[model samples]
Target: MPTLDPTQLETLVVIAEEGTFDAAARRLHITPSAVSQRIRALERAAGQVLVRRTTPCTPTEAGEPLIRQGRQLRLLLAEAAATLKTGDTDDTVVDLSVVVNADTLATWFRPVLDEVATWDRTALRITVEDQGYSADALRRGEVLAAVTSEPKPVQGCTVEPLGRLRYTPGATPALVERYRKGRGIDWSAMPMIVYNEKDHLQDEVLAAHRATRPPVVHRVPSSHDFHEAIRRGLGWGMLLDAQAEADLASRTTIPLPGAKPIDIQLFWQRWRLDSIALDDLSEAVRRAARSGLRPTRPL
Candidate 1:
């Protein structure tokens, strides 16, 4: 078994985060040559290339476990130092990286922000990803936690149901009427909107109706922008129940007649670590989900 040096592992993690050897050197307060030497020594010890020398350096597949290990080590050390120096005015800031779906960010997840805002010496780094794919960020060690649709836990992580986010297929009243064919809306001819290529809610609705996506598909990636696009009559799209209800009440949007609501069961997946910061965040997340999302049930 190869023995990994703590300093070299930390340097490799820093390089991956900083995206360049020079940047890592600056961050570590060492010379770029020193950074290169450490990386070389580490790679030699491991007998594999740990990082890809790209525009922004990325850990190779073989390096992911080490990267995760480095981050976990750093977090534990920070926590231990903070514990040992209790009330000594040594404010140790811990970075909490989490990946969340855009819809959750715009909706129920707002409360988590309020909770995190009150914490001392904590920095929140949120990566917006689609729910279906957010777990991939966890697998790549890009985030410490994720709001995902995957029920299975990623390796080294634990999964808990966060409840379901219900979506209604809706469109502007005018857009709905424009595509109406006799007593029914033309599912095949109506224009559609999607948050991104990863978003499948609209497609799922179409499939349920035995219809294919129309040619005039509009991509509005931002959650707020996607909602606004629907409000502006750009196209029909699946919207969160809260968003749909408000729009429907205001006569701005209407649910497609006979369209069944889609409920996506969400889960909270986090690294299995004994970090206080992570525990605080998980509690906040669970609380917010309970308040905003429907109760978890078989999907």
Candidate 2:
């Protein structure tokens, strides 16, 4: 590595996160040509192509290292500046944004917040997303951390296996008797409620039967609403063990036949910054995930 220009390094980080050279240049109040020149200069210095310019840009393997380093440098500089002022910590709420699933929030994930409150920090800004999709937010720098279904690490982040969250195929008793007796879906004929247009809960179950696709679909976006829709017999859907246990015990739920089940393996993806505050937060989240999500077992 040759001598790095902090300005160019910042530009590269911005471009990678913002997804385009024009966007990054706009952010820095510099001309797009200037941004391009700086990037070209940086690439000459590094002797490798850093970014692959596509519709939405993607970092090369080489670019990821610089992007991650840039983020760490920025975070360390901010922490140092904050410490120098001491009182600046309380200036405004330092929002710590994170992407998490709705059920995990309703489950033991809250314990992480208890730990967060124990530390001296600012307000939390939580963004609920489907576990599978949270990594996009991390790459866009929209969130500092995420509880993701993906095991792969996002650029500028560290990935830790948080464990699996087991989901049981469940439905209300009345719904069960009405749908499970002999009607048991075959999945194609079953009327199923889904989380949204993009949800695949029913498809996952139906795929086991070698069915083509779900015939009936109802979209409810909220996890609580999704559970309630199943409980009300609107349609059957998969319920997370942590969220459905009480209902299942009270006989409100009737489990679907066949032992095959879906377990979503979650991971903690976070910026690998050396902030004491972030370290404490990562530990808290890890502890909560260990207790909240179930261990992965052979299906």
Candidate 3:
């Protein structure tokens, strides 16, 4: 069995976090040559190239497991040190990295910020990713936890259903009238707005209507902007149920006729670590989800 050096593993973790050999060296207070030596020695032990030589260095497929291991080890060490410290003012701050979808951030995930704000000794790092793709961040060990649409947990992680985020196809009243085809709006002729290429809600609506995408498909990546685009008549797009209902009551936007609501089931996935920070975060997330999201029914 080949022995992996703790120092080398930590060096690789720093490199992965810093995104460059020089940056990692600066963080570690070591020379770039020294950083290179540690990585080279690690790769030799593993018999596989670990870090990809890119502008923002990334871990190769073979390196992902090691990166995760290194992070876990570092987390444990930090916790242990904090526990062992005898001082009344132990200043060990645990870095907690989490990924959340933009829509959730704009909606139900706000309370999480409030909860985290009270934790003086925890450093929070948040990555905005689409719920459907957030699991990729977890798989790569880029985040400790994620609010993801994927029901299955990543290896070494635990998953629990958070609930479903409901979306309704909506458009400005003027836009809908302009594209009205007799009794129903012309799905093929109307311009559409999508969150991004990864967004499929608009496509799902179109598929339901048996229509192809219109020539003018505007991509508004931001959740708030996407909702505003629909409101300002840029193009029709799906809006969160809360957003749509408010607009509907205000007579700013109307739900698309014959379009059914889209419900995306969300799950909370976190590394299976025996850490109080992670557990507290998970509880907070669950509470927020319960308050803001619709309960998911058994399939």
Measured over all alpha carbons after superposition, the RMSD of each candidate to the real structure, in angstroms, is: 1.7, 4.4, 1.6
Question: Which residue pairs does candidate 3 place in steric collision?
Answer: none
Which model is ahead, 1 or 2, in terms of TM-score? 1
lDDT of 1 by residue, 1-299 (tens): 69999899899989988999999999999999999999999999999999999989999999998888888887777777776877763877788999999999999999999999998778899999999999998888878899999999999999999999998889988898899988878899999999988988888888988999898999998888898999999999987886667788887888888798899999999999999989999999999999999999964
Per-residue lDDT over 34-121 for candidate 3, one digit per residue giving the tens place of the 0 to 100 score: 9999999999999999999998999999999999888888777777767777585387777888999899999899998899999867
lDDT of 3 at 296: 89
Model 3, global lDDT: 0.91
What is candidate 2's lDDT per residue for 1-299, written digit by digit as tens? 59988788888888876889999989999999999999999899899999898968877878777775665666666666666666655453344668898878878699987866765435567898888788887875656789998888986689988888888887777765655535454556556887876677667887787766556677888888888888888877888788788998997877876626688888899987767767777888888877887865444
Q: Quote model 1's TM-score.
A: 0.95
Residue pairs of candidate 2 with colliding backbone atoms: none
> Rank by TM-score, descending?
3, 1, 2
Off by over 4 Å in 2: 1-74, 85-94, 180-186, 296-299
Question: How does candidate 1 score on lDDT?
Answer: 0.91
Model 3 TM: 0.96
